[model samples]
Target: MPAKRTALIALLAGALYLVVGVTATDSLLPAGARGGDTTTTARTDTGLVRGTRTATHTVYQGIPYAGPPKGAHRWAAPRPVRPWAGVRDATRPGPLCPQVASAYADVASLEEDCLVLNVTTGASAAARGHAPVLVWIHGDGAVGGGAYFDARRLADRGLVVVTVNYRLGVFGGFSYPGLEGSGTFALQDQQAALRWVRRNAAAFGGDPGNVTVAGSSFGAAAISGHLTSPGARGLFHRAVLASGEGMMDMPAGAMGEGVPAYPHYTWRTGQESRDTGVEMTSSLGCAGPDPRRALRCLRALPVKKVLEVPDIMNAFQAFAYGNEVLPELPEAALGQGRFLRVPLMSGATLDEHRLFVGMAHDAIGSPFTAGQYARALVTAFGRDAETVGARYPVTAFPSPALAWSTVVTDRMWARGTYAQATAFGRRTPTYAYEFADRDAPMYLPLPGAFDFGAYHAGDTPYVFEDPDAQKYFTDAQVRLSDTITDYWAQFARTGTPNRPGLVRWPRFEPGGAVPHTQSLGPDRIGPVDYAGEHRLDFWRRLAGQGTSPAPRPTEGKEQMS
Candidate 1:
């Protein structure tokens, strides 16, 4: 079968399992529980789960870490999975959580019974003391993603890898008048998964106390949440935040506030999220004078009905803060030194926002004209638009579109990523990086005219066995992939990214005038003047509404090889 067909079949099978798991009564207490060898039939606290061992490792898929957050359990903290009676098959991955369809992923066929996880351990991991547990939280914009990374390679390097799925959209974030913990259901689900890992890491030969939480993009955003969440304390001892950080702030407001422009990493208060839920209640045909009745009615609606409601469905892409789970904005928490000080490896692709700009160009079927570029800055940054345009002039780049890409990359991602990394470094052992392969693979289509150098999510292939890597990587890129995995595994094992013979990734020292960041690319790993290269000072000044300072021309030279 074709790859797409096979993947679709797997997804359909997940939906089928979803039906079987949630048909009549409490779904967490699935009837079957497997009891066999510890490797193949590890006994979790809840029940026996029969996992499949591959030629190189033990693979366990679709293990329930939490009870189904459906029916009476919807919008509540995940209940512990009830013990089962017979052996349960742990071969196939669980259903993908509900999410909005995008140009990248179409998860319309999935369901709400998606709180599941997958684990991969080295072949001898069960022998004891060899494998360190790496719990992965897949990236999503609070909306779409599932636990499907092929971590066999990472596992081969003496690690036990765990991937997880959490609720998305309204099912994950809706908060209203009577809902006690409504705004943070997805976060609660994450904590539940961590709790499960803490309880069962030993069965798979994973060290419970050495757990490392890692994620990319939105997953990094989530790790940031966990870093700040008091409820998540002690669940994991180390973190790897890729592409996004916990304290990333966008101008706070509505999702569509920027329209054709993108919003910064802003979040909502519980009341704001509740108000959103109120509007959603009416949108879903559940509106009434009684708040309790409306919520009850909303919960009673079929999953498909919720999916069919466009706004409620799309709302999965955002999460709300200021609740018990989040309490305050993560950035604020981190700034105030109110976050867990763990070993952190956080970084982003050099041209992070270029992918989005490429998509925008693809949307209009043309490059951004100078006028359009100016208009966007004005729209996104308002009175400061001229300062932004003056700093990132169209004449300096190949086209106005590329200039716009550079502007946003530095403005929203680079500067804030640096600031947050610096903030964390003051309190924790922090390592920072930037994937600077200017000719990095184009995971998505862009006009041949546009080069999305080190585009958003560019580092993903280096970390996970994404099919795109197999499909697009050159021989040199594959070598880089190996190097990248080594860095990731080393970090998970020791809370430091350095190994015997690679570029020494320096710790981010914020008290200094210059911030040192590593650059990862094909056959290249070294330090770069990251702040100067991205003109971060200019962005900081612009954001501060102060006189903009021109950065010396990008220190284009690598400090080390």
Candidate 2:
């Protein structure tokens, strides 16, 4: 974030505080509520609640869906939150799940008491009645993110919008010996939140049976995982996955370690996850010959002591098998038609890897040399290095840096996205998209040398009404936002993104060799050959021949939603 923009937001927030007679921090506050006068109270399964009334919707925040995962409950499946006695104040969003500090911390504070959810519905009761429900899960490498997204627009569009905060980092995903298949605490938290929605949607003026689980990046992978998790079955009827897919992962030893690490965001077995946790235990000097005793010693350490150690961030913390919750890898299960037959929407950005490589450029100066680009490719793609280079020659691109970003975009992001989308299409009604807005805003400025066009997470502001970023959108972009949100809300309501007045978005044909993926940008919504656009043929050839895939180095947002 730029200093000038930060100061401007601070000044505007201060002005809002004066106008509303309440201090406004970075949290998502209703646009125009003052002195608690909005009569935003409602009842829940657990207790009564009060929210803040805005022009468009009633906003409820800090609603717990599960018990706090702390101390003795650290690695356990989420227990139902105990009911509260009286009406609870819910005007402000809950704190974020504990995480290693990152950009998300700038907006929402961090706390262990973070297994909470937020709801947004029409300000008027009639407007909310029978509205479709949309539950959002956020993704940022599963390290940070929460429910700070402002969903008043979607709520006003006849939808009940629920955003969630789950466990993150090692706290939410760590597994050790004797705790087999228990590393997926974050996923468990999501299921509990979904169950809460199913039980409480009617109270929020939403249709309980018409629910959609939507997310991006890790959040996308998460909902996709839920499609295969027995515990999450029958909870949601529809799904949306953006900037993520069912088959995203890295080959072993691609990131310099014999053990797959950091960029590998896929399912592992219980023993594989336990092995990684043991590495953390050894790093903290809590290792013992008896693995179970070492696990106990690691658990005994203070949460602060554990979180403060920055090295734990690199450990793979995705869901593991060997338990009933997630019986197998979502991709493998999804491949074999083992997932729930829900209507699904999945996509990635046109330039998904720019966000990552732009950050990497911080260390490597602009205009990378051929050797540097090849070395980076070898690091990400391992054995497929030569084939990948032959396909995406550095001389063919404008620069070596451009060529590298293209490989990361194609091989790491687009490849998995294609595999996952077509896989889901094979089993259910599906919609695929490629966010192709080349001039999307750069939240974090890259040096002049990097062009991170339509990068990963770029479509988030379009999904949620962003007060800060929206201020800068051109008329064309605002119209694009309207189109995107309308499509999403329509999908939640009717298991499809198409409506009467909008351009037709054809559903993915289950067995099409290469289905048409809708291209979204300023005043444009048309189908494109997603397979060819991302060069999936090259990827399929590489994968079919048992060649290595690629990965990215870095991975943020305040609202992991």
Best by lDDT: 2
lDDT of 2 by residue, 363-402 (tens): 2354467888788767667788888899999999877767
All candidates' TM-scores? Answer: 0.86, 0.87
Return the clash pairs for model 1, or none. Answer: 32-86, 33-86, 33-87, 34-87, 34-88, 169-316, 250-264, 250-265, 250-266
On a 0 to 100 scale, what is the lDDT of residue 287 in model 2? 75
Scanning candidate 1 in windows of ten residues, the lowest lDDT window is 552-561
- Give the C-alpha miss distance for residue 509 in model 2, angstroms: 1.4
For each candidate in turn, give its C-alpha RMSD to the true structure in angstroms: 8.5, 8.0
Task: Give lDDT tens digits, candidate 1, residues 1-561.
Answer: 011111222222222222111221222212112344333778888888888765567777788989888876888889988789888888666777776454344345347778889887877898866468898877653344444466777888889888888887678777778887867887888899999999999988889988899887767887777777879888988888887745555431111123333232535666667777776566677888898888788778888787665455444444567777877777777765667877888898888777656655643376668888777777767887787778888899988878877876776788778867876776777899888777766544233556768877767757666554456788888888888899989998998989898678888877656767888988578888888998976776655643222222222111100
- TM-score, predicted candidate 1 vs. hidden true structure: 0.86
